[model samples]
Target: MQGDQASVIGGAIEFIKEMQQLFHSLERKKKRRRSLSPTPSPKPPSLAAGELAAFCRSAAADVEAKISGSNVMLKTLSKRIPGQVVRIVAVLERQAFEILHLNISTVEDTVLYSFVIKIGLQCQLSVEELALEVQHSFSQESAF
Candidate 1:
């Protein structure tokens, strides 16, 4: 009887060890997956997107027009701000809007970035970050 009890205890220990190994493998796979994707999203307060965010609101108000079968409209224009060229795009829906700002410096030749704002919220009362995630998806998938 004592022998049987000892064997059961040994079996329990082995089972626990196997479970630990399985859990560790799962954790490693999860981490690896996270690492392979595009950029992680930045916090809104830290995004340096003040200009872009306001542009989204104004763009929403003054949308030139909407493209059929697609919600994206874009225009590239030289910046009034000296030495800057800007490409602007607006993605509009019933309650949400996404705007991409591609700013290029004519003289620097090295400074360029794209700021995307997704703020056409489905609910008027929805949180700001909720709209941000839609923009985040685009940035996460591509670097520019």
Candidate 2:
């Protein structure tokens, strides 16, 4: 009975050591993951963001007015502005695909881009030359 008791005590000590090692390993992995994690993203713009939203809506309305006044249906186009990438989709014959994908870094780039796209829709400039022509034309405008 004494020998059996010694063996049982030794087994418990080994079990406890294993548990401690497991806990230590888990803690090390957690610390490694934390250190490798990316910097936190900025907090999203607050309710004051609505001011920018309203301005965008107004600009969209102006563009809508321009397209609607002509034969083109502006409603058929969809836009996705995700961060610095601007994607414009146009549907034709029941199919939809992106027509414009512009990477813009500032409000000015977006504003100028909108003007370029609007003029491209109205003119004979080839797809290859449209961007340059639009930039040149917008640059010539006094309001810009």
Candidate 3:
């Protein structure tokens, strides 16, 4: 169990380091692109209020579904999961918009799409990892 904990901690630290490096690399690229482009880049279209609401609803439903299907989640956490997911999605959407605005001028459409997809996947994995960690912690406490 101690070994497992150490491995998990080490993996998380590595993940964080990699993410930091990625962000720094992206920042450098953004600066290079901005310097090369003299004209103002067109702003990426923001999601309409209705569209955002629809997205939130869909995300909440997904969370609810996962909670109902998963035995690992505590009852208390399950109740809050949908709301938390909506908030997480909202924040992610805002960050993605900012990233798009910053890089749209210089980055190819395919590259931007890939970047967004990667971020989304990473966020999902992070959330799942967190949930498992919480469940593990609670289970260990209950065993005491």
Candidate 4:
């Protein structure tokens, strides 16, 4: 019985040592991965002020046109849509800028332009979706 008890204690210690080694191994792997991964740029790539202004204007104009054309959009909402679109574009642009800087060594003008275009399109889609929801809500309210 004494010998059996000693063996059980030894087995537990062996298991604990194995677990410790495994934890250390995983920690080492995590450190290695962190070292190998590309670090984010200290500062995001600077967007030219002129280019940014041009993009905002173009995006706002496009949103205005869509809102104007939509029969279901309320006049008040239509007035606000362009400003909202600009805000959305600003947020998206900041995120995209960070992501671009992190993923690529250098950002090109064309790539930035394309990202802006995509952000504008996304904002347009969001506005359209909001319009649809508003229209549905209005229709439902009218029914009662």
Candidate 5:
């Protein structure tokens, strides 16, 4: 009886040790995978307001404004604003442009993005058009 008890205890200790080793190995594998994965480069901040607006207008016209995200509140013509990154908060499709709202807040207001301006988290606009529009818009603002 004593010998049998000793064997059982030893087997239980061995099983516990094996489980600990297996857990350690799994943790090591996860760490290795995390280290080996490639890191993506950061995207440049979108500052070209005119190009963004034009891109919004043309792209909105092209796709018939079928987009989704934080922007969903600006359905009226008066609510639409150019030259800003309006994150789509919600969406409702119409014949022409998608009605969207944003998820941003200000000292006096809470604004919505109101369009498919940024497709899949990145705003789409051609570089040359963007540069030209930015210059023009800034000049216009300065003159005003």
Candidate 6:
């Protein structure tokens, strides 16, 4: 009876050792997987846009008419700012009258993405004027 009991104890010890080996192997595999995984990167802000040339082409007739026509008011001319990334607050026309939040970059060249948001009605708004207004607004706000 004593011999049987000793053998049973030895078998239990062997089982425990096997379990420990398995646990260590699993831990190593987990570490390897983690090392192979890619680190996450911060994402840039994204905006949807129509191409400048394409938008111009689509709106060409209206643009030409406005340019040639003597009655074109600045308010009506305010909508044509190129490269203007607009987050629309409201849109009144397929080609005009949009309430938009403009994003203009000041960093220089394509690196900065220079364009400004403006509210426009009737004909398209002028890009240069909107940019000036936005810069002014930002300066004034910053000063205060």
Q: Give lDDT tens digits, candidate 3, residues 1-144.
A: 999999899977964664554345446546656689554432222433533111101211211101211211111112223134234334445433212211111123111101122233234434344333333332232221
**123 in model 2: Cα distance from truth in Å?**
79
Q: Give the top-scoring candidate (TM-score).
A: 3
Candidate 5 lDDT trough over 10 residues, lowest sum: 71-80
**Model 5, residue 111: displacement in angstroms?**
46
User: How does each model score on lDDT?
Assistant: 0.33, 0.29, 0.31, 0.31, 0.32, 0.31
Quality of model 6 by C-alpha lDDT = 0.31
Tens digits of lDDT, candidate 6, 1-144: 999999899877964663454345335434544699653321221323631211111211111111112221111112234333222112223335333322322211121121222334454545443323333322232221
Question: What are the models' TM-scores?
Answer: 0.26, 0.26, 0.28, 0.26, 0.25, 0.25
In lDDT terms, which candidate is top? 1
lDDT of 1: 0.33
Residue range 1-144, candidate 5, lDDT tens digits: 999999899977964663454345335434544699654422222433432222222212111122223321121111233433322222221112232223232211222222323333344434334333322332232221
Task: Encode model 1's per-residue lDDT on 1-144: one tens digit a residue.
Answer: 999999899977964663454345335434655689654422222223322221112211111121212222222111132222211232233335555433322212122223333445353522333333333323332223
Q: How many clashes does the backbone of model 1 have?
A: 3
Clashing pairs in 3: none
Give the per-residue lDDT digits (tens) of candidate 4, residues 1-144: 999999899977964663454345335434644699654322222434432111112211211102212211111111122134334334445433211211111112111111112232224444444334323332232221
Q: Which regions of candidate 4 fall more than 4 Å away from where they truly are?
A: 37-144
- Could you give the C-alpha RMSD of every candidate to the true structure, in order shown? 21.1, 25.8, 18.2, 24.0, 22.0, 27.5
**Greater-TM-score candidate between 3 and 4:** 3
Q: Distance from true position, residue 96, model 4, in Å? A: 54
Tell me the TM-score of model 6.
0.25
